[model samples]
Target: MELSLDAKDTAFRDEVREFFSTGVPDSWRDRVRAGLRLSPDELTGYQQRLAARGWGAPTWPVEYGGTGWTPTQLCVFWSEAARADAPHQFHQGLELIGPIIFSYGSPEQKDYYLPRIIQAQDWWCQGYSEPGAGSDLASLRARADRDGDDYVLNGQKTWTSYAHVASQVFLLARTSHEARRQQGISLILAPMDTPGFRINPIATMDEKYHTNELFMDNARVPVANRVGDEGRGWEYGKVLLDRERMVAAANVIFLGQIVRGITDAARRRKIRGRALADDPGFAAKLAQFTVELTTLQAMVLRLLDDMTRGADSGPRGSMVKLRWSQLYQAGTALWVEALGPEAAQFAALDGATLPADMPAALQGALYARVTSIYGGSSEIQHNIIARRALGL
Candidate 1:
């Protein structure tokens, strides 16, 4: 596929660049470029700025405050944002829940949630995975039983990212015992502040508290909070999961980080004043990284093209996920090899405390290890490709 930007796209790209350059706060941009994490307020503030420009939900319909751009334009937006080191603002609300609600939610639900989602009024988190049900989500045991007008939810959700900071969570709960495992599920919206709800922090390998374990004991949510028909959570969840995997695979920021890592490694030496980039073996590794990146980018563009043609990528989404995850992990491993022992000493630096020269690349490499584990894991993705795509 031709990756060149056309004249019109070039103009659009310039406009987007100017807006991001001027509209986003310099402090936040600096922090992002330095490999630091943004505070919740900083992240929300950036989203609000994009929301004001009607660019908050890039993939939604125009009626829902989306830009309504073409797939290519969307790709350009993401690439330019990463190039500028802008903080990611579209994942939780715009990418995940916004689509789910707009696709499956009632008009009242749309009216109630879409505005807050666009305006960044409510931070959202996923409530899908549990301790026993990470990749085997159909085996989830989180139960939600109807009691009059409300569903009493009782179960624990593990690896709920940003749960402590989120105002709401979209959850999948077991609503029936008679139906098959995948058939008895329902999607429910649970407020984080509800009684009997508890969020316990889980310290990650990177020393961050971004993920948590959520406990619910008879937490009550209105029946209206259900996203779609009862006993159809698995079907609806497949839609959300497909979309999630696609977006997660299209994370161009990781590509940028990989590029930066290669560049930094090239500038540094391994033994006795030999630049790592000068070594033929290390140069070959960098070349291999570039090739993998190119392949992943092309695959992503093809998937986006399929989406543009209204063709379901289906299990091909897992192909993208698997390729990107493998490439990302390989690139990071190469970076660690280039850095040698320095990889161990560099702690993951927050956006506020990043140094100008290659801060936290090692930490990022460590975090990338989990990239294959989370979001259905690479093994699970491969199984999906085999079963759904290859007729295995």
Candidate 2:
């Protein structure tokens, strides 16, 4: 089918394309396309540039430093950004907590946090998952006891991404022991430098410090830092989770970029004096991925359209997350395999410069194993679709 945009969205797409071409630096794009990690300074600096242009938080309300674009425009922005290899803005702050603070926070809380988040001034991390609670987040055991104007927090949070670099954390702590596991949970904001807070990096097979374990030993936060009412954090967390899934729908565009890179590599590499791209077997696999990616893109558009019209696309985000994760893993595997044994030259976290394409592709495939595991896991998404969408 010919998937076409309306005149307005088409113009917006061209505008976004122009900005990415001119506004973003070529070095950043090259590094991102190679799957090399950008430093914190590089990330924040780029975000600041986007903020100055009033496009820092694309999906946010206009009153809150967003572009006020339609869902279609927002989709276009993310798609182009991915294709251009722009550094993704820190979503823990912009996509997750910024909305929560604005929608459920006190006036003082909004004034303090919103601008900082938009400008990338204060990096934030989520403190939701614990040793025993991840997919079933309501089972988190972090405790927060009221002590006058302060709440003393004590718990351990595992799989906390970017805690080592974050200046703040939004924690979900149990304030009371209610009969229902989901009840009595409260969202609390605390500075990472709090006297009793500690962060230790967890080593991964990729040789990267991408996640951490957090220890909160009597980390005292002002009661004013509480988001919404005490015991209503479960409700706020649900909102953030929903937004996270929906906002990530455009990630299929990145997969498209990966596939394009694979095709380019296939054309360049030769096997027995013939280009790998000419091999029927390899070409067929690439063609299948292209078709699957096109279908996923259509699903994303339909989800955006339904959201714009206030229609409930039940478990649609789950479906996208599930399919996208599977495709990402498969695409990365294909990319590395197509590169031959040269793909085994992997880059570590200590590398100062971007690795060669083959090495970077390998590193990316190693990391791709986590795609299906995080963001509520493939199993959870299947269960969601089975019960909600399929009525099975």
Candidate 3:
């Protein structure tokens, strides 16, 4: 497909670009560029600002406060925001559960949750992964036994991002064991302050408390908190996961930032009396990454167009997600390699900050390792492509 903006698109793109340049706060932009996690208060403030701008849930239905932009316009918004290093709406509330809720939630649920979500009154986190159920989410052992008006929850969830601070968590818990393992599962919207729910922080090498382990001990969640019907949580989870596959291309936004940082570093550093960027081998490597990145971006555009045309991008999306994460990991690894001795400085600092680019490169490299794992692992993605796409 030939992808180029005509006059109308050009105008829309300019509008989006100007909004990002002036709409996002300078402090927010700098924190994102530096790879720093925003505090809960900062996150709420920024999300509220985006909500006020009517861009909070750009892809949701218009009745739910969506912007109703065309696919190309959505692309322009994301591209402009990425280029500006602007913070985005919380994906959990805006992308993941928000879609599921609006699609399957009760009318009351929609009226209550969607507004709070839009206004940043509630922060949502995914609770799909348990102690043993990261990639194999179907194997989650969290239980919610029925007790009249409530279900008593008991189990642990690991690697739940932002659980410590999020206002709520959307989890999948087993309500029965008689049928299939994936069956009898139900989605629960558990409040963070619910009795018997606790969070234990898990700090990573990135010097960030990026995830947490959640423990639930006889937590009483109302039957009303259950999303859709019980024993159908797996189906709902699939909807969310498919949505995740769609946005997997979003890795490009960060990949672009890393590539720019690498380019800046190379342009400034000298290699044997010449700019590092002038080296023939270094230039060739960058060219290879550029070509691959471009191809990946083209695939993303195709996926978006297919969605707009009401096509099932399914297995094709698995391929895109797999490649996007792998290419990102490759790009970040190459960036660290190019940093060489400069990387060694951050080696001991838990992630160096001086020279600016060094820490960015190192942190990107470390975080890239997880890119292939979350949303879905490279292996699981391969499995989907193999069985569903190729009929192997």
Which residue pairs in candidate 2 collide? none
Badly placed stretches (over 4 Å) of model 3 are 1-3, 23-41, 347-353
The per-model lDDT (C-alpha) reads 0.77, 0.81, 0.79
lDDT (tens digit, per residue) of candidate 1 on 1-392: 23588899999989888886765555554335334357788888888888888888877788877788888888878777776667667477777788888888899989999999989999999999999998788899999999999999999999998998999999999999855688889989978999989999999886656889999999999999999899887787555765764485447433654666566666765566788888888788788888777877877887778877878777767777777677767776676687676555554456444233333555556566787898778898888788887889
Deviating ranges (above 4 Å) for candidate 2: 1-3, 29-31, 34-37, 347-355
Q: Candidate 3: lDDT of 250?
A: 59
For each candidate, give its TM-score against the true structure: 0.90, 0.94, 0.93
Top candidate on lDDT is 2
Model 1 misplacement above 4 A = 23-37, 252-254, 268-271, 347-359
Q: Candidate 1 vs candidate 3: which has greater TM-score?
A: 3
List per-candidate RMSD values in Å: 3.1, 2.4, 2.5
Q: What lDDT does candidate 3 reach at residue 248?
A: 68
User: Comparing 2 and 3 by TM-score, which wins?
Assistant: 2
